[model samples]
Target: MTTPVQLYVYDLSNGLAKRLSLSLTGKQIDGIWHTSVVVFGREIFYGQGILETRPGQSHHGKPLHMIDIGETAIDEDTFNEYLAEISQHYTADKYHLLDFNCNSFTNDVIGFLTGGSIPSWIKDLPSDFLSTPFGAALRPTIDNMFRRPIPGAAPTPATLQPSPAATQAAVNASPNPALAASLLQAVASQAFSPSASVNGTGSSAPAPATQPQTSSSTSTVSAPVHICTNPSSFHSLLRSHRAVIAMFTSATCGPCRMIEPVFEDLAWSKTHGVGKDRVAFVKIDMGVGLGSQVASEFSVRVTPTFLFLLDEQKTYEFKGADSSELRSQTDLLLFQAFPPHPHTKLSFPAVEALSSEPILFTQVPALDSVISKLASFVDGSSSPSETVAAKEKLSQSFPVYLKARFPANKGAQPPKNLSANPQLIASWAEATRTIASVLPAAQLFPLVDLWRLSLLDQPIATWCSAATSQTNPVHIFMSKAIDALHTADMSARNTVLVTLRLLANATSNTALVRSLLSAAGHRAETTKVLVSSLLHADASVRTAAASLAFNVAAYLQKGRMDRLRGDSSAAGMEVEEDGDWEVELVSAVLEALSNETHSEEVGTSFRAAA
Candidate 1:
């Protein structure tokens, strides 16, 4: 059953604003509007990040207007996920009174839930208030009320850190608390000042700092981790790390100077970010006081010598400064230390060679054509009032949002580093649902096509992948196309074509592939859809279905390979005993092969799946 979505509009100024607005601002304002979306039996509002309470239980007290916006097709989980994604932009530091205030937030939420904007009066109130002479004067005061300092608020160049995602992932996956904490510090340092060095690369170094410190408390820059100066500190690092590479050098050695920069780069690239607490790079100068002791203990005869230690034992030793050999040995050791899954060795050439890229339908059509199609669906007199409201809001807003996100020069593809604007995408999701519930099967292609391209954006793809089947836009629409197939309405072929391509594109994300192929209900739904569509009367539907089938097979093959290779983090984490899906998939492909006549592409896909 759909949940009824309500807008709880509160007056922040109590009754005083309504009474004093005419005297203060020369125009009568209803209230200093603060709104929350009331759905799933909870009232959600944005303030110091997204917050929730029992409806009418917030500090703002009971709402003045409990407006019936519309019912939402999305469940609590999906709505909450949407809130989390959007909340990144609505932090405490981002809040403003006249601009980006509570009303602005509610408008976004209302659009997502109902594909309808908030009441014009409430939305226009801030702009209307700002236009007044008295209200204009208070703008700076209002801005100051919300403005606050944020630590590490400045953007850092991304190239400083080797791979932030890899570093964070390693940290989380680490079983050792002390190691996790150490890696966590590295991540924090990178977060604040990515360009800052973690460990000192100077010839005469000091002991590494336990934690990074900046010049000032609020400074964006952070100090680098100093290289170990004494034998005691060197031994401490060796004990803590799984692998340690100690470089013995002297200030007078020209080769040492030549290789110092390379070592420093490796230290930052390997230890600070990607490898977590696994490997450490140490530099010691024999010319320095404590460095002579370390050099003598390691038995270094010449300057610019390297020792690769694993678990405190010297595994490999080399002399002279050959950067190429140093890199090769470090890579080899890292590989030996953290091996890839062995299943990667077993090559089934056809399926293995299949492109891992999600089959994206990225062709940009004229926006007018899409809007015109939507217009046809909603322009009818029989359309529901809520649908009409949603259509109006969507037609006005979506195209503008889409163009801004994907400019004309960029050719409508998802832009690099797409800003986190969950509300606009959520609004589109709701609008699609609003139209899909009423539009005929034949009319869904255009809307589905729009959604297909939108999924190329990582955030949107991630959100949809993480959503439940009931709430996943891809699944809901794909199931619609599958339902249409039961009626054998050939007119719905184009709808099926795009829907299949949408599924293929959605699988571009690993999480989506896991959801589609590993979850039992979703696996069954997808398998049935593919099997049924393979025998469709239209060759395009068959071909699209075949391509989707190939993607599914490739995903399963990858999972099996990962499992065989003993990768604990593989998407197919389930036991091999749950091979029922594999059997079913193989059976379906074989059946398709038996009956396939047209489309060489279909046969190619079949070969790949096999």
Candidate 2:
């Protein structure tokens, strides 16, 4: 049964936007759009993650307009499955007013359900807001409004609104087990947050994207907290940070001036785990004002003095201008603050040397052939001829967009924004979903090949790499390929080869890689595919399988190394699961190596995996 899909659009400004937008932004905006998809007897939206309510029953009240974009053949159970997959990405913390908002979520959902999009006037509002002087000026304010709560301000009505999933046990749980473990350790040691409860949630939203400029610091680059004239502010910093590295200096001190830059650089070094809420670097100018009072309290008499505090207790103090010593002591403090996994102490030189670059099969086939093959697949399906037209449109326009965005010259830099025509994006997404669903596993190579090339581009990769997308073409395609691998057919073998290449390209997104590998059933199926394909009769299949193994191994190896260095960025899998993964991967590689004879290429790839 085809279910009707309606786009329920609400004006967030309550009709004030139409009255004031022109004066404020120098643009005549229709309304501030807050949209939801109404389908399968429910109104679905993204706010505090994926939410659903009875049609016309949401707290937003009745929508200003509801457009019947189209209908979807997707059943209720399948749609729920889709929701479960995409929910993690659409958390309340991830929501933003500009870069990714309710409209973005609706657009993704609409594209999946009906192969259509939300109205352009609604979809283009964020960009339209950004194009104006007032809007551009307010970008930071808008971001901060959503990113963090104002200090000491009363909670707003929106903040107090209960999530629909508040009753769910996992609502308060950390998605990643390793992260939860780290949090527990930090809480137990009273190093991370002394007052923070084990179940508490804090604002760790990513900083908003800045407008294009000659230079701008990214969200990862953090500035040191300064306590130039305030002695009281130092205590707050000490309470908040797990470890505080305070540099006490005076303006007149020559050595103090020399080491200020070094202190600032340490705060910005992401490799040192400087950013986020993990560690804080402070600069205190004690030459004048209450800075002298702070200096007196700490009994700092030297021109350049360093104080290292863990959980507000002084662990180390030094009086000098030694840059190397500063770095070494900072590293030591962080190591104590965040101890490494025991696995880091073990040796794995071969895994250490493996290339981390994703093995992308970038060879673009003749466009005419690829498109014609795709058209044939569409023709075989129950889809309309327009589906073929959409597929052709994507095949022609996507490559052009990629070329314009990423030129052949090594020095060329594309705009950070992946602002292709919305129609092209919609068509590409619809076509991918259609092809993956209708095409048999044996005949999936051409579409898989195109997808592999598409993943090389940032926009497509970003969209597809989400473990659960509106359409989830990548996950669906991967599942299909893995299932087909159990068969002995030659065509299945061919499909698996291309599928492995596609998997390799997916490794470019670390989060996506972790998401795919972390699922127990998916990981088991993938292991079976790799093990069987490694021993396949065809050398190409074996080589492709080996290449995929290398990518997965490299990813796991890097995660292990990150943990060793006290970098929590790659912490996702549980400790036991991570150990099991290494053992299983190594066993597969050894099993394949024992039977290898026909091709040295396969051996080399397997050796890389080993």
Candidate 3:
């Protein structure tokens, strides 16, 4: 015959106890069975029992009692006595009494004592429950019982107060808002003074009071100013003053070591400025642990990180190792800190002085004699051969002036080799090109030929580099060259176009728009050729052309609209008959017009006319 066993389980955290049942037979006794017991506040509250059984109906069919435990309403003493009886009857091997609070035991015993299931809350028990210096100790037998994994034991609620060490750790981890607010207020209340005592002896003294004091007003009179000493206070001072100089450095950094003296000198000199009270100098030492933390917060990877905080919001940073470099950086920071007055214009005293220099015209004996001879030769009518002879003689005697003014040497030797002197070559080309425009065509061709040969073998990148140099005016020369090439023979035109196409494609040259505009009118034929080239077979070339066309259209619409209006032929042409270039140009104007749509009809009409 078989009977069902009723198992009871208890949960302490939720204060709920539940019961379950399973059937068991004689043959199934050898197999494992699982159940649970629950304890709360050092007392076992309930026990659960589990059993395994084979499938069958009892012959008696009297609802056989497979296993029966008496009521779970037993108190602690009765429960312990029952546990002992069960433990002895099962030889401490077959049956088990599991205690979650015990220190050492086996899993099977734990499974049998508790039901087959484990409660979720048992995982949070403290490792050491009563091993305190104050003589508190966990019961040894219970500690031994708890060492094993009970199958269905409910966890102990975590109600223990934190240990001293743990509480200290928590306090250290969290920021104290009260302390932070107090520190901030303390910093804000203290002022920063760059007086003679603080920044060395100064010429200017502190301003005296101007307002007259009455007997009643004596209480409102000012008191002595106190300066902030700590770094946080210093930071507050800088914020209030809107100072620019902030040096972030480490004591061990070599660069910081070198620049510290220079910084000190500058800091001392700042007191002499008009806004001495406004200018602040602050240095942070990133050597200590707290400094390292701050450095991490600021994301400062480099030492000697000089930040020129122009205002509270904007900052310019300079990172370097040289003292001289730091000095130069300081100059720029000073410029940012105390910018020039808005109404004041910049002036160069040397240039202004040179403007007043007396002009001198040097007498050239050769040119003077040549002019006289040419005058005499032109005064009389002569045969074609005689005239040609006189002109040939004058041309042969003409002195070629090659006066060149090189840029002042900036503490460097000029390259002696002609091949290396790109600046000189570019400048010479520009001067010759300019002179060619007003000079006779015969004289111009020779200069152009010379420049073409000189630049023939040079790399495109090299040519571009020369063109974009700050000191060289290559755009001006290029403009003239483009103009000359348009009117020149087919070979000359092809040469100039090849050069221009190279310039257009080069990434370095950003002045292409300006150069093209300069070449637009004088080299209309070249412009037409370029515009036609845009429709070529190559995709890259086509893309570049499209971008250029848009850029050119926009630029012309903005800068050369008046010039386009001045053209008499364009004025006569009908709007519909206008070419692709004119259509694109007009489209750009239309787009600009759309933006200014609110203007009155008179304004619109005037804009259209212009």
Q: How do all models score by TM-score?
A: 0.46, 0.51, 0.21
- 174 Cα displacement, candidate 1 (Å): 25
Model 2: ten consecutive residues of lowest lDDT: 191-200
lDDT of 1 by residue, 105-190 (tens): 67667656665667768766765665443343344434333333444232223222323433432222222223323433332232
Q: After superposition, how far is residue 260 of candidate 1 from its true place, in Å?
A: 6.4
Point out the higher-scoring one by TM-score: 1 or 2.
2
Backbone clashes, candidate 2? 0
Judging by lDDT, tell me the better candidate of 2 and 3. Answer: 2
Which candidate do you rate higher for lDDT, 1 or 2?
A: 1
Model 2 C-alpha lDDT per residue in residues 25-61, reported as the tens digit of each score: 3356777778889988778776655666677766677
lDDT of each: 0.62, 0.61, 0.33
Descending-TM-score candidate ranking: 2, 1, 3
Point out the higher-scoring one by TM-score: 2 or 3: 2
lDDT of 3 by residue, 267-333 (tens): 6555334344455565555553134444555576788876666566436666775667666776666
> What's the lDDT for residue 233 in model 1?
53
Candidate number achieving the greatest TM-score relative to the actual structure: 2
lDDT of 1: 0.62
